[model samples]
Target: MVTLGLVFAGPCLVAQQAMGAGTDEVLQAQLTQIAAQHHGKVAMFAEQLNTGKTVGLDPDKPVQTASVIKLTILFEAMEQVRAGKAHWDEPIVLKPGDAVSGSGVLMFMDAPMTLTLKDALTLMVILSDNTATNLMIDRFGVDAVNQRIAWMGLKDTHLYKKIMKPATEPMPADQPKFGLGKTTPREMAKVMERIGRCELAAPGEPALPGDAAICSVALHMLRNQFYRDTIPRYLETLDSTEEGSGIASKTGSLNAVRNDVAIVAGKSGPMILSIFTYDNQDHSWTVDNEGEVTIARLAKAIVERWSPAGIDGKTLVPGLGLAPVAGGGIGASK
Candidate 1:
């Protein structure tokens, strides 16, 4: 049975004065209420773009970054192109060895296929294509990717290897292999800030030589993130029916973890948020109540608190089916 422990850590509200006076208290209170109910650790960071005010719960705590690491890959790939080390349209062939078993369309394809660098990137982000990711990792060595992270002044973020590769296969036994990359909420948000400001691949350096074109492409890819299915639907209320008002974000989930990070363009300014949850209680990916509810409840609470007016009248997203547990009831089951 899945036991639910809901805890709200409350918002850190760091650098609050810059964000204005009353906002910090409200955010902190809300986050605190949310963190009190959970059993596992939750690390999150939210930054208001205009004032650069930020808040977090264990913001610096390192967490297993699932697909979010792809953002780093995307940055490095674009930087390579900007430096004239590679071309966006350059043709590359996909071989059998590049295929990985989970989450992507390429593994289903059977023949020696080819795609341009730009197309590969599109597949990587849009579909979370593992095959394409491995290929890119091969092209740009892991060392190069980590070098960029260091240059950006992010100490807790690093890319160790490809996610699709199994740890037991051929690589050094001592090497970490559960995921391709890892990062803390604080570090991840910093990268998002850099990308938002177009300072990632600064010109005339080892990465991208002062070429704004490269930065422009990177920005476009982020803005066009393919996975829109998981963003809390309530946030959509503010969005125009034609032009959704919500932000572009990514979702990552594995056996024992689920994560969502967003760059929200709010009324004040853009905000970068990274929420990570890890549960060791149940490692099964199939249907572990403890693990699923922990993440679902947290995500729901965030959406509800962040946009309470929008969600008060609506139903929770279908799968979660989490209504408030009145009188300690289990709420509605899915």
Candidate 2:
């Protein structure tokens, strides 16, 4: 790993070397500007697959992942299938008891219904569906998910059970608290890299019955994510004529946080990026609209800045960074 000097200093200086030479100054400047503009702690990580190079701002700082942690749930579910503890095609009943009050279309359904484990997983990842996630988590067992997190060697990531309903207020001591997921930008990127490399399967582990076929199935499910419907809409300003170098991405948000992570097909190879912003004050449903637009804009700007023609190797400092002007629109209210 190459070390980069910080052109601008402060708390952002921690882990500065993780970004490599010449890039640290650029990232520090970007983070300083973002922190000033948004009045929030913003951490980001981007890795170039072709070169094994990474650039980040507060890369290891732990923050709320919001719905982005669903990706972990998605991966763990796939791993369970690989271990023969569950089946992708197994039927799961959508009873009222399974409902969770947060994001997703599944929460609006009236009658109890049935869906395959595979379809539920799709809805969970593609739509960031909370109801689907809760049902799956209940079935898979929250303890199992945490076990997988430990098994995967993620230090600052974990699920604190599952949130079933929107909080009217903080809960009492004995009542079940609404458990949300938390992680740092760097840890999230590691999980994405693992998925891209098809390394979700534990090594030296025997393939359980019916598990061998799951690898392709898991890949297919990820490839067919429903969020694709919103990417073009969000990234409309991007030069789409450059065919075949598309991106696979997921966006997550809460009241004050906005985030997006993607694996971009670059000219040299795939590039992975995870950008997270927290404590954003632009919460208006009308002024800021959906936070997704802002998040997408950030993503586009990072890609443009980091790519060959984007920054010209010059560092982006305070008052000197590119901003994403447009992209896919934000999702409707959760």
Candidate 3:
């Protein structure tokens, strides 16, 4: 593994060297080279779900989340349902004053509209809808969300405030530094892993009878996510809308940053890729944005190296049918 210097702000974290069967010196070298060539700083972590083989670059460095933080909100919603704090069909009102600017059609919709909690969550994940996200934040307090994140054992991950709105409560000293939220590549990847594996309970707690059902709902929404310009750019072969892509992902973008976190069900096994690029020179929102392309390149390289036989879309639904590891039980694939 190569040791590269951080050219951007914040403490430098050494890139995590590849481990287990996924530990290909050539692959790690390629990843380093790709990161070095990019116009911005890059941080990523990828894990093969079945074997626990992993690879990463600056995986522990915290960075701006942009819309990627929505994943946390979605996770909290799932937990709420599991605890009977909320229900999927619960009615959620969207007042005219509630709508905020930036990504999503809900803001453009008529004022005082009523939608189900499931509808709001679907919009939040599939569209990266800022309005839907804010609605969720309002429904689920910011403090509650952070508590959920802490419960996950993530130290650096945090959701600071709602999209396009001011933080009502006092914020951390560095809240302005990381816009909507912040999280390390590894932490965000862990969140994705939990959803993929359907381990909804807190550590050591047994999963509820409906945990798999809730996870299926979340995974289905992610599988239908509309933004595929980043990680799925090159690796996807089918129309995700018509025939679901083997990948379940969420993307976040800013003028100078691009992020994507995904669970790819490959022929080899299920893998998680959490990638972030920041302080980029190319800020274009086009499909060819340098940061976007950089993420795509990185994902393509990792997926190809890890799953040479390619991915299978059929494995993504019904709890990812994830193969059991040493202690975890097997989930038969649909």
Q: Which RMSD values do the candidates have, in order? A: 10.8, 8.8, 5.3
In model 2, pairs of residues that clash are 233-328, 234-327, 234-328, 235-328
Stretches of candidate 1 off by over 4 Å are 1-23, 166-178, 201-213, 229-232, 237-246, 280-334
TM-score of each: 0.72, 0.73, 0.91
Writing each residue's lDDT as its tens digit, candidate 1 over 81-152 gives 766798999987898777887778988887489988887877777577888888888788778898988877
lDDT of 3 by residue, 1-334 (tens): 3344434233222354435455555666788778877877888988887776677787888999999999999999999999999999999999978998888999899989999999999999999999999999999989999999999999999999888787788889999899899999999998998899887887778878999889888887888788888988888887666566688899999999999999998889888999999988898889999999999999999889889988875557545674422211012232
**What lDDT is obtained when candidate 3 is compared to the true structure?**
0.85
lDDT of residue 110 for candidate 1: 77
**Lowest-lDDT window of 10 residues in candidate 1?**
313-322
lDDT of 2 by residue, 121-207 (tens): 878876788889888787886667768888888888777656654544454342332137777788888877666655655777644
Winner by TM-score: 3
Q: Provide the lDDT at 27 for model 2.
A: 46
